[model samples]
Target chain A: MSATLVPVDEAPAPGASRTKPRLAAWIGYAGITAVLLLFAFGSPFFLTASNIATILTQASVFGIAGVGLAIVIIAGGDDVLNGGIDLSTGAVAGLAGTVTALAAAAGTPGMVAVLYGVLVATAIGVVNGLSVTLGLRPLLATLATMGVAASLELVFSQNLKIAVTGGFFEAARGSVLFGIPLVAWLMALIGAAVWWVYGKTSWGVNSYAVGQNPTAAQVAGLDPRRYRLASYVLSSALAGLAGTLLVARLSAAVPGIGTQILLDIILVAYMSMIFSRRRLVSVVGTVLAAVFVAALDNGLTLLGVASQWVGAAKGLLILLVLASVTLRGRKNR
Target chain B: MSTIETLAAPVEPSPGPVAAYSGKKRGTLQASRLVAPGTLALILIVFSVLSPVIFTVGNLFGILGQVALLALAAIGLTLVVRAGGIDLSIGVALDLGALASAWLIHDGYRAWVAVAGGLLCALAVGAVNALLIVILRIPAFLATLSVWFAGTSVQQLLTGGGAPIYLSAPLVPDGFAVIGRGYFLGIDAAIVNAVSISLVVALLLGITRYGRKLTMAGEQPSAARISGLRTNALIASAYLLCAVIAGFAGVVLAARSNGYVPGSGQAYLMDAIGAVFIGATISRYGRVSVGGTLIGVVIFGLLDNGLNLIGLSFFWQDLARGLVLLSILLAAVVLGRAKSRPATGIFALLRTTKHQALTNTAKGNRK
Candidate 1:
């Protein structure tokens, strides 16, 4: 799919001009640095290698998920359509972890458990895609499924702790290559896959075409609905993988663990989309955005800012980034 | 003949590949299929049959009491959405207003004064939203989301992480209690409040010039602008209207709850938006209709009430509600498109009408 309808005046051919976006990039870099410095100066707990690893470890799942979401956004399905929003990612992940836990409990091999979890998560993603394609407002459809999936998790084990009972949890907890968590490795795999599909696969082109101008894409023979569904499904699958890693790390599928996941993921993903310099989303860009946020939060926490104020800071960053994007987009138009 | 000349001709030979697609007729049919009350009716029946307690007076009143806050909140949102904008901050605005009112009442302020103060605060928030979007050039979604987060944090900070403000006996004067709990004729206060608000909004949307202009701006901004409508002003004013209504609703909810809690408004945001969206599907208005919103609220209320009566857990109830919403949207899309396509064998009125028009035009050309 190609966007042939060039809006009368083409804005400087995609990244061709030497004129640098120097200021925005600098501000972003500076913000990252300032937050890191503040953390280093404010607390002894912040400087520990373990703490740094922990922060990055925790940030990986969200960053991985951000890549998928970035695809959906760049593909031309505005996150707002059909009442669309993805609030179910965490729940989807939880369900996947629960499946893995159950299988692990049933004396399944670690590899089998992992496969089961991923498959279930992928199925859930497919459900999400179907609902969206069938014209259910994205939010409502996903919301319903989120509730269903969450409830199913509750009913599955009555909120039991099974992540540890299974060898799968051990694998999740295990370091694969010198102290790096298995979950971090999973993040890398997911990131690499996403990057490949986004940059090297035809799906990548279709995604951009769909997101940037669906009508144009449709005229050029791409099925907009199909691509939209695929993007959502891919996003759900990634989220599911993230969930599996979470359970593997935590050794449990606690019912309430997913409460803040959606908010955090959406904030980072939305912010990333707005700041995507290429006007097309990139895996690198999305992951970096997630890292930027995680760093900020960790830094703030290390700085001994009250936990309550941490949320406010996240909200403030979202405002600043999104505001800049909207303003800049308007100026370009 | 050149393709351009052939396109310029009103009556083309047979039909072009895309000539069958007509926007207005399809829109009307689609709009009719999307009406809100149908789902409400279905849910009401299903719930009534599912639980005997669902139809009981107390439960009905409970549902009404719950819906009042959201209904009020949604009135403002409906106005905003109708004018081609959204207010994610309504949730926070509700929080700020409810707490502000509670604080004032605790500080020995008159209940009415406190309520007014809350409304004013909400209005101020709305004004800020408007200014940010219209003047600062912030997108509606980002601006409102920021305000929402900021307002929520501000309220949280003010409370010092304490519990919500509780009203003393003196603050709950007879008049105030009456508004919160009293019955008007046979209808409870909550019902009365909800109905009255719905009616007022419906009237405003239906008869007012401003309402028409707002709708026009949303439906076709370029056309509206060409007609000299002040699109930005209308958009700003719409947010303002939504804020005031939401503010008032917040006060009412606080009164009903007997205090303002930190989490008071969090749960209602989705419900309010759902009602607005559902309501839009209900009428010819296409974006928002007060009656439709009422129906949406009723449907949701019934579902919740019935589910609770059946001893269903929170998770299942949420899933069911989401399913209903999703089904409604899907049904809208499917049914909407269904009507636009060649109808069934017995209902091929569209084909015939076009055929007749074409023949008549051909005869005139021959003459």
Candidate 2:
């Protein structure tokens, strides 16, 4: 444990004096205008309710995952020291969902089955943490777990999709009391919780301090290994939650559930982290970034573009965000 | 005794007490590297023993072909990794380069021209990666991942999201096929390609000033820069070399498969990275060795071939690979720790037990 340090006083506090230069503000405004124009004149399909709903759904899952991943990135630093990437998030979710479905198929209670799935997900996270804390490179460690998780999914269940328990599916798929989608509600709750923990807890300060300098943190009487382990564990658990919900909503755990999901999750999360300009992880920022990507994907699909085209666009957007952030960082320096 | 001697022979000189302690702490880590390939080999041998077809020439050759492409790329990657940069984009670069070469051939360009074009294309991508990392200031991991995304996109665009091209020119096919298909005095083409690349890369890395610079950058980037070594230039060269080799391997790979798809080269990225890291865990049981990577690739290939011959599903193959990577990584860590911490000494003894005491007391006070 360490002293709790509020991020608000760190730099670029929300609602503080506007630091936006005229040029940056104009560019931001212009970018928004361009997006609006694209939606308006590029295609009428962009305004469809189904398209909007699908985009929201996509954003909700990805945004939740992004928030969790961003915390790890912010806690680890620029180099992702000890190789602290959480690539297995999608795979963990996939495996967890598959297991949950398998259990439900065998007559397990929905609640109990879901709990088992989450525990499995936590185990994956624990393995990731153990490897990194014990000196396994983060990328290699997660990559290994990803393979294991993917294989386990295939072994436990063939490529076939399994239906979730009726109650769980209906509950997850339905809208909340308000007009909000259940997925959106879940995402919002996760995001708000993350924001609170990151801003108001000793854990958050420890994470930031550890990322800034692991050796220094250790010298300062902090257990760098413990913080990193906890961060990875939390991140993995959150990812498991995302996976469980995805399976519940869809009513099936399909093979390849997390196939290529890492691309979007990592890209958007990193973009959000960069946009915050503090190199600090922000749940709100990651959610917005995910929303932006989901909107783009949804809009393009509605416009009749192929999925491959959408993939290409995602890559371009990642590059654009990375480039802009990098340029800005250099300028500040 | 022979086994013990072999294991202990390659061990680096213990750096006094600190080194001895580190060595002891790294016991599991040292064991893990060899363990991965060993486990892989064991599974392979067991499968091969059970399945007659696993030992057949054609099937073995097929596996060799796959291993060759992966080993060549891993060799190139070894340099970059040794220089402290990992190239995630190599896989995509290979795809893009292959596509470029294939496109050239399809457009009536000579085979040599196509190959050159591929190499040039790879070099260009590699250079851009360097600029991003060395000049514009991006971390290698992110920069390389970006390149992966960009390169794959470009490949998809050029191929129009279609299947990979097949080259059918007679002489070109035959000559290139020999490198991936034809055997020399009973040696498989793929094995030849892998062995040749390994030898060349090993020699270059072990004997050249460039190799020294590569390690220098990896071990201490700041110090290397301070030495006025043109660190960025060296790094760019290393990445470029890695990309070119990957590109060449790509073409050879496409020929072996007889066609391409978006996912053709996808599997190789993880395999190559694993091989390189695992190999790095070989020397001193915790350092990298080209010889070790060759063994890694061969073990992987044997495992894949043997499993398929034994009729195991893809799930089993994936599981085996995962277990190998994790086990080896774990071994490397254990070995590294063992090497850094001495097995005995007053200060060392105090550091472990007393340190815990101090921390516990400190925590109690804070509470």
Which candidate leads in DockQ?
A: 2
Worst 10 residues of 2 chain B by lDDT: B1-10
Each model's fnat? 0.23, 0.28
What TM-score against the true fold does each predicted structure earn?
A: 0.86, 0.84
lDDT of 2 by residue, A120-231 (tens): 9889889988887776667778888888888898998877888776676677776664655778877878888987776567777667666544534565688877877887
Model 2 lDDT, residue B117, Cα? 82
Flag regions of model 2 displaced more than 4 Å.
Answer: A1-37, A45-50, A81-83, A163-167, A303-306, B1-63, B167-173, B285-287, B342-367
* lDDT per residue (tens digit) for residues B185-251 in model 1: 9777866887888788888888989789988775455457767899879888888888888877777
Report model 2's chain A TM-score.
0.87
lDDT of each residue in A139-159, candidate 1, tens digit only: 556666776667676767577
Candidate 1, after superposition: displacement of residue B150 in Å? 2.8
